[model samples]
Target: MSISTSAAPDTGRGPAEHDVRTQIIEAATAHFSHYGYDKTTVSDLAKAIGFSKAYIYKFFSSKQAIGEVICANCLGQIERDVLDALEGVQAPPERLRLLFTVIVASSLRLFFQDRRLYEIAVAAATDDWPSVQAYKHRIHQLVEEIIQAGRAAGVFESGTPLGNTSRAVYQVLVPYLNPVTLPHVSALHAEAPEALYQLVLRSLAPPA
Candidate 1:
């Protein structure tokens, strides 16, 4: 992806600051992913795009802050995919199906585009990035709400544990849809996402 840049402001202050900040983030992600997180430096990030380290610092206080922003942006993209799928669908099953399909497709596509970045971010995630973690929880809550809806409609079996099922679905996905691991599992090549979805649905669906 091209690193989008912002024009310098006449007043030397405005949303351009925010746009420049985003540019720094985009550049940092590309650099950090290409070179492992440990190897990437502020000078490298700044020089990679012909900007100065001082200039980058004006926006990001530190490398960790930049990493947090990039990590949060990745989660935000996933949230957008979920919200887009949730829009316009009223039926619980169809809505749930769409949510599953969109997340799988979008995640797979994104991971394929930059597996190293995701890998690095995943490693960093265990350290507890609250913003990213919160976004992830929001997405999980959205899925849980859909499960609850399905239960209310009687389309899915009643009395199913929505929280546990939602967590299970999350587990099945993070590995299955991930590009780094998908190649090792042969079944994942054929109908991985659908199979996983069916498993979750079976657990949560009302009695036959």
Candidate 2:
């Protein structure tokens, strides 16, 4: 019987494959954070992980694929944090405020610390990838829940379908939440986040 030394590229196919893939993602995240996505190469990653360049290819198809994995992990973390903050909050407006504050602060931090993840996120958004679309859709639903809650509590405007109003809010906040525009937003420092948050809240509320 001949012994095979080569292992095929697989994702979640087996413990061996999953472990290798996880190792690759963890190592790739560090390299990308330090050198950025554009500058980091598969060979560099393989060298860091003590694997051959071909072995890195066994788990990830390209640098972009690896970046996507990183972005997913990072965004999932933010999502979990956001959901945790929303728990046990009875006031809709208060919940919305907390949501935006955490989102802006976390996004800014993510941009500074792991810009490679943000860069790949922007690219994914630009390309309109399905996974990204689903991600955004899920986020949109969460925000929509808040909007609906606010409407029920009489803190937000009524008569419009919740989806329409929530989507409009999402569009306005896209500058802050969308990775493609994050760099541009970071360049400006004219207004405080509280000011921006209040402005967004005002847009949703009816005149006194």
Taking all chains together, each candidate's TM-score versus the true structure is 0.74, 0.78
Model 2 C-alpha lDDT versus the unseen true structure: 0.70
Report, for every candidate in turn, its global Cα lDDT versus the true structure: 0.66, 0.70
lDDT of 1 by residue, 54-156 (tens): 8877776667667766665565676678788788889988877777777767666665677667765565455656554676567677777887788778887
Best by lDDT: 2
lDDT of 2 by residue, 72-137 (tens): 666666676778888899888888787777776766776567555566677767886555665677
Best by TM-score: 2
Q: Which pairs clash (backbone N, Cα, C closer than 3 Å) in model 1?
A: 156-206, 157-205, 157-206
* Number of colliding residue pairs in each model: 3, 0
TM-score of 2: 0.78
